[model samples]
Target: MQVKQVETETEQKQAYHVRNTVFVEEQKVPAELEIDELEKEAIHFVGYEDEIPVAASRLRFVDPYGKLERICVLKEYRGRSFGSQIIKAMEAAIREHGFQKSKLNAQTHAEDFYQSLGYQTVSGEFMDAGIPHVTMVKEL
Candidate 1:
């Protein structure tokens, strides 16, 4: 499994498809929220397994915080560390770009996953995309 940073339009499209499958279709995330206008400025990364796109995520600046969003991996590839790899990719990008901190609104079910990645719960649970979510952050 190779974690590749997407630098071209083709890789960007592949990353979008990964997000659409994991977030829009699988998680039932609204099309409006999942499809945002921030893609143009967001830093994106795509993970490939044997030349096939399998997981992805992106980073964006929201004032003092570096927001990591659109993190998703194919269902068949979930048991592996694709999600972790994508998170690391996003973290590296944020650090390279000189960010003070990072944050992510993680689905409630995935809190443990993010926490394991050094993100701590900073706010009470809330509903996003009609699903329970919590705001978590990691000081960079």
Candidate 2:
């Protein structure tokens, strides 16, 4: 398995496909909410297993920090730590951009997963795309 920062249109499409499958089809997040205006300005990453795209994430520079978003792994790829790999890749990108911190709105159910990666909850539960979520932050 490999994860790399997406730099081409083809790579971007693959990232979108992974996110669409996980967020839209499986999680029932609206298609419109899964893809948003920030996409054009975000740095995308895609993960592959045996040459098949199976995980994705995006990072956006938000002034003093970076915002990690849309992190997802294909259902079949879950439990393999690909999600952690994606986050690591994004954190690397964040550091490269000179950011000292990164933040994400994590699904409430997955808060523990992010916590395991060194992130700390920073906000009370809130709704995003109709799902319970909490803001989390990690120093890069």
Candidate 3:
């Protein structure tokens, strides 16, 4: 997978497409909840495989940490490591901005996956977008 920061309207759309498919359509998250006020301030990323967008995520500088948000990979592409690739790319961007920590509220089911990438569970289970989640953090 080739991951890149979204730099154009087209790239942004590709990111949204992946997010919508995974979060809204597949998971039934409310469409309104899928998008938030942070969109304009966050740094968006998209991953492409053979020129097709398959994954997406966004980053926000929340004080001492780079907050990862809206991370998702198309259902068909899960287990292919595209999520890890996009996350690595986001971490690189965080480091570029001098952040030493990365944080995210990961869906509970994916907690182990994030742990494998160096994230540690920081909080007990919670809910977001009607889905179970937990806060996780990693030292970059």
Candidate 4:
């Protein structure tokens, strides 16, 4: 499997496919909330396995940090490190763009996973899309 920075409309659609499966469909997140206005300004990444898109993520250059967003992997692709691979790819992209830090709002259930990836919880739990989440940060 390989992760690539999306650079074309086709690749962008592939990224959205994975995200829609994971977030909009499986997780019951509203499509309108899942695919928001920030998309055009973010750098998107898609992970492919055997030429099929399996994971997706995006990064936005927010002031003072690179904000990671919309990270998800297809249900069958979970527990196989695709999530980690996509996040590492995003971090590399953040560094390439000269950012010294990365930030994300992680679902509370997955806080430990982000912690294992070197992100630290920096805020109290909050609700997002009707699910519990918390802000996390990592110095790149």
Candidate 5:
């Protein structure tokens, strides 16, 4: 298993495919919410378990500080820490981009997971793409 920076067009497609499989196909998130127009600018990542993409995410540096968003893992890879691996890789990428802080809107159920990674909640829970979410931030 490896976490790689998605560099080519094919890898980019695989990343989006994995995200769609988990968030759009399985979770019922609107296709619009799963695929965004900002993909072109965001730094993307894909986790491959022996060439099989099992997880993915994107770093959208929309603000002065980067924003981690669109993180998803295939169902079979859940509970195996692939999600955590993705986040760590994304954070390193954020640091490489010279940002000292990053933020994300974590789904309510996964708040503890992000908290375990040293992210602290910054806002009350709210709804996003039909899922409850709260803003979280991490200082690099």
Candidate 6:
């Protein structure tokens, strides 16, 4: 598997396709909500397996904090650690921008997954897009 910080339109599209498959199609997140206005301002990352995009994520610099969002791994590739790779790549990108802390609104069921990566819950459970979520943060 290979993961890189997306720097071109084609790369960005590939990332979007992965997110579309995982978030919009499979998870029932509205297409409009999945692809938000923040796309243009965020740094994107994509993970590939044998030249096929399998995971995608983005980081938005919000002042003193770097916000991680739209992280998703294709259903067929879910168990392969591509999600972790994408997150690591985004964290590196955030660090490159001089940010020392990163945050994300994680699906509640996946809270443990984020915690395993050293993120801690920073807010109580909340509803986002009709799904339960929690705010998580990690110091980089």
* CA shift of 3, model 2, Å: 0.7
lDDT rank order: 3, 4, 2, 5, 6, 1
Error of 4 at 126 (Å): 0.5
For model 6, name the residue pairs that clash: none
**Local distance difference test, per candidate?**
0.88, 0.93, 0.95, 0.94, 0.91, 0.91
- Listed in order, each prediction's TM-score against the native is 0.93, 0.97, 0.98, 0.98, 0.96, 0.96
What is the alpha-carbon lDDT for the whole of candidate 1?
Answer: 0.88
User: In terms of lDDT, which candidate is strongest?
Assistant: 3
Q: Is candidate 2 or candidate 6 better by TM-score?
A: 2
Model 1 regions more than 4 Å off? none
Cα lDDT tens digits for candidate 1, 77-123: 99798899888878877888899699999999999999998999999
What is every candidate's alpha-carbon RMSD to the true fold? 1.2, 0.8, 0.6, 0.6, 0.9, 0.9
Clash pairs, model 1 backbone: none
lDDT for each residue of candidate 4 in 69-94, tens digit (9 for 90 to 100): 99998989789999999999999989
Q: Tens-digit lDDT track for model 6 on 30-127?
A: 99998889899888888989999999888899868899999999988888777888888888888988999999999999999999999999999999
Name the regions of candidate 5 deviating beyond 4 angstroms: none
Model 2 lDDT tens row, 24-132? 9999999999999989999899999999999999899886879999999998889999999999988988888888999999999999999999999999999998899
lDDT of 5 by residue, 43-100 (tens): 8999999889999999988666789998899998899989999999998989998899
